[model samples]
Target: MGDLTFEDVTVRYGSRRRGVTAVDRVRLTVPAGAVVGLVGESGSGKSTLARAAVGLTPVTGGRILLGGRPLPRPGRAGPRPLQMVFQDPYSSLDPRMTVGESIAEAVARDVARGATARRAEVTRLLELVGLADERAERYPAELSGGQRQRVALARALAGRPEVIIADEITSALDVSIQGTVLNLVRDLRRRMRLSMLFISHNLAVVRYVSDIVAVMYLGRIVEYGPVDQVLGDPRHPYTRELLAAAPDLRAVGSDLAHVGSDVGDGTPTGSAIAVGADRVRIALADVEPADPHHPPSGCRFHPRCPIGPMVHPDREICRLTEPDPEPHQHRAACHFAATVETAPVTPARRSR
Candidate 1:
């Protein structure tokens, strides 16, 4: 009953004629008791998917299901089946209401208990989030940044939701505090066996928190699979690029560096494909992504694909036809996924 499925879900903003397509037929599943991490750039629609799932944002096409049933509208009377822990805690919390009152309000949604019982439940929730009973008497303004974020989590949990969409809950905290919040989230998820959709731009954090990982670009899932498979040995060029950009502690004195000099003329501008480069161009390094309103003709990532020019079998096809989401070793939206998987690994250069 804890499965959260997105069946070809799509979300677009504005009118159909001039709409900006934010999410494009994304299909993902967060199985019961598993954390599925969604990682992407700012405009990549990670937050939009979370918002759309809980009915905060509009779902233009397809549907999101909870435990095999369609999600009910918000404020429909009963306990909410899904909840969200927002990125910004200060804005989400009411400055006027005492923390206890806020948690009590959510408790009252399901519990018919009197003030005494509600207070007990509030105290329990505060404890669950590692907050003290005394802090419950304070307003949102009195809490530190991390404490407020915990309150937001406690309030979300007060609904006893089956699915929690945690949208970058640690992005606003200091690194030290971020670790604390992450530890709390991991501990709580384990204790409650909660299903979660963790969204973040931090690859390292995503790697640590997720059982499954979904990588988004523009408005599409470019890759998704078990955390180790997706991040440890990524098949998508974008995923590879992202991993290469992240600092690897093991690469300090090793020859396994991914750095290389630019190989192409570097003259091509905009999001159009360049066919003249003889070697790999590290396309994403220089190319500007296409506007969402006018994505490329074929593959969405073709314009900025590092190996688009180097791969012969699928090169022309990638420029003319859209590749369906192929699930082999893992799910990837690239036509050359097979080739990428079988491609020989480049030898690590000696550190000079």
Candidate 2:
């Protein structure tokens, strides 16, 4: 069974005139001992979802369950069963506290261990994150970016949480250092049997660490499935676009320099229209443009969609109607997902 589940979750900020839904009806199941990647572009709601999971961000609607039971609201629940590793490690750590003290404090609060045991655990946690035991005596200001990040990770692990939400934890580090941290997290996962929700915009990193991948676009999950199936044979246009954006070393000097076409003006065409199936076709003409403050009527993607002459399959309605997420083994928000045939080459223009 999954260790965490998000059921019809939605999060919006502010009153009606100023409100924006950061996450919209998002559903996810994070299986125990598995690493799940939440991949998307900036403003795709990845961070918001991460915050919601640990009660850092209030849930505007819906429920979050841990071990099949509802999670307590923030503050009321004491320390969370889950921990988070922020993107900016330097800012996340305390400048005043020594690394050992920071880790020890976290251990004391979350693990309920005594001071002696906390000190011992701090030493082990620092080592587990690849920092030498002596480094623990240093302050955050004394450490390098990578070392500081490792310290932050150690503090998060001090809680021995069943789940860890790493929000772009490696994006700020050097490429060389990134690999080291990635390997450390992978090793720790195996050693501790952890369930992780890894959030990142880097597709390559996500592919490397995630057992399952979910692609988000403008606050909604456009595609979700096992990592191999979704990465190897992507079913959603947005997912394909993300894969295309990932740098491929093998194609360094090859003709496949560019992966997909650019959808300027948000108008989708060419490969965006899925062919070969009897699925309902929802065309772009039926809907209006997306407004961050007030999104368009019907399908959120319709203004940019290329498909034409298609009606809602289940309801026989026009593109002005919202379509439910596909009910396949893998899920997609597009109404015409089943009918769309993914092409090897996406339509985006190549980068020079």
Candidate 3:
């Protein structure tokens, strides 16, 4: 199995006065040959987790393992089993190097190959990513956004990695172009049997590409499950909220339009957030101010919760005590998670 696993992973940055716990204790297992989508807003720690996976960021606590092997610490050479495709194609590529050369660099580093062999492999990669051999001679400045991204994909694949972490790889492309990249990734996954962690804020994209889905809030995963279970019948309030926000033909005439506004509120409710059929109970009122250095009191989510209206069995205690992640059919963190229901969604009004 090409599985990737994280056990109680936590990452904190800065000193007491200005520090932030970018990622809280998070545990996840991504099965081999599956595309798992990590969804969260800009500061929700999705990027942090992605960087940590490929050894770009340090793990303050916990461990990351690929195929049962622990990954090296940050700033060190990773196991060479994982590679990442960054969000911005424009910035990730070298303006000075041709697409062919960029791919060549990655291939050479991973595989001890001479110039001729690298060139041949680069040509094959270009074809695999749907780029023409002639396009390899072109520079990043000379290609379209989609083409540039394709080159980025080619470069990542050059390492022949078993696990690929694609962080917002298609966010910069037009909707039409995004589909092309998504299809390419889907194809590659099947052909190479590569396991991937596809991170994106766009639910539709996540649903389209993922075999399983993991939803993040603040710095922790709130809900995770098989794509069909999580996307088709989301159990957690947060998961329901995210699904409601996704644009879909089936969502017409529903109150889902207000999803954007609700999620942006940042209110921490004493409720459970799901993580792959497991539940984590957290009490908002009890959450201590996440340490100026560490911040591990009651519930980190209590500060901005809007669902206080819903009374739960452990509302009082949950409001005062820190809850831990409990294994459920799905995973979540919330003291009263079992009692919480999906909040009512209101559709956005169209201008007359």
Candidate 4:
């Protein structure tokens, strides 16, 4: 395992002018032997970044570094320095081939020079992932969802990659099986000291195994730091909003009755709900995410910023200046990030 750095990496699709920017100048690092949890909404580009890291997607700008060296072009000789285990094991594995054959193909020739050596290596990998060597002879259709995922992981390890990118690897499994895969990942990291970029929207899953957490939004990394510091004492407003919306948040807090009504003709217009019963819905800025094809002029999040022009019309700065996520103890991409909690905006009822 080695240090994996996304150095101002930018990934775009289509022409420069009309293309969609999937990862926008994101800067983050996965320290050697550390598991970095990448969290964000579905369209926030977490997966795109992971795909770019493993050469599945092309980088439009900047570069990705492994151990401070540029990533080699794809289709090079020898074992891959980086490997990826995709979200769906069913699609990632070939249904036509036996798991043993699949895993054997991934084994570097140097690691297993002969037929017997390759067979032994395949068996060893199967046992390493808690699967019986005999099970390797079974097709993907013959195994459970969890077993297929385990085989996918074993195949990745066959390459002996320096860094592993696991993209929502367990989200597709049942909760019972999810824990098993997670525990296996934890144990594997401990046993192999593997550097991993673990992507998931599940905050609980991220908190359980990651030493560092980086939150992405609309193709940009909005916050990142030690998992404890970022999750425990979040500096970014987006991060706070995520924490407030956690499924268990209501377990400790009392629910409030709905207040305020539609402003005109009893129609539910965007501005009708003056004060939402709960703040977790991005109350002040209940708008859909801006299109990446044509992002906002200044802050990409201004249209949905809880503390920006949506709440304080006088705070025109947010609509005019894009903020960079400068490095800090708990880095965040926000202008009014520090004052987020101090200047809470309690929505007032709109005059009838």
Predictions in order: lDDT: 0.77, 0.73, 0.71, 0.79
Q: Candidate 1 — worst ten consecutive residues by lDDT sum?
A: 266-275
lDDT head-to-head 1 vs 4, winner: 4
TM, every model: 0.86, 0.83, 0.80, 0.87
Model 1 per-residue lDDT tens digits across residues 1-352: 5699999999999987898999999989899999999998888999999999888997999989988889998668788789999999999988889999988888744564888889999999999999999998999999899999999999999988899999999888886677677767777877999899999987666765678999998888999998777766677777765654543313221211222222122111111111222223344546787899988878787887876743454577778887777756478888777666323233222244
Model 2 lDDT at residue 214: 89
Predicted structure with the largest TM-score when compared to the true one: 4
RMSD of each: 8.7, 7.4, 7.7, 9.9
lDDT of 2 at 187: 74
Tell me the lDDT of model 2 at 31: 92
- Candidate 3 residue lDDT tens string, 108-186: 4546468887888999999999988998899999999999999999998888888899999989988667767877887
Candidate 1 local lDDT, residue 251: 29
How many clashes show up in model 1?
Answer: 0
Model 4 per-residue lDDT tens digits across residues 121-229: 9999998888999998899999999999999999999998988899999899886677678778877888999899999997666776688999988899989998777
Question: Which ranges in model 3 have alpha carbons more than 4 Å from their true place?
Answer: 73-79, 108-112, 249-297, 303-314, 342-352
Ranking by lDDT: 4, 1, 2, 3
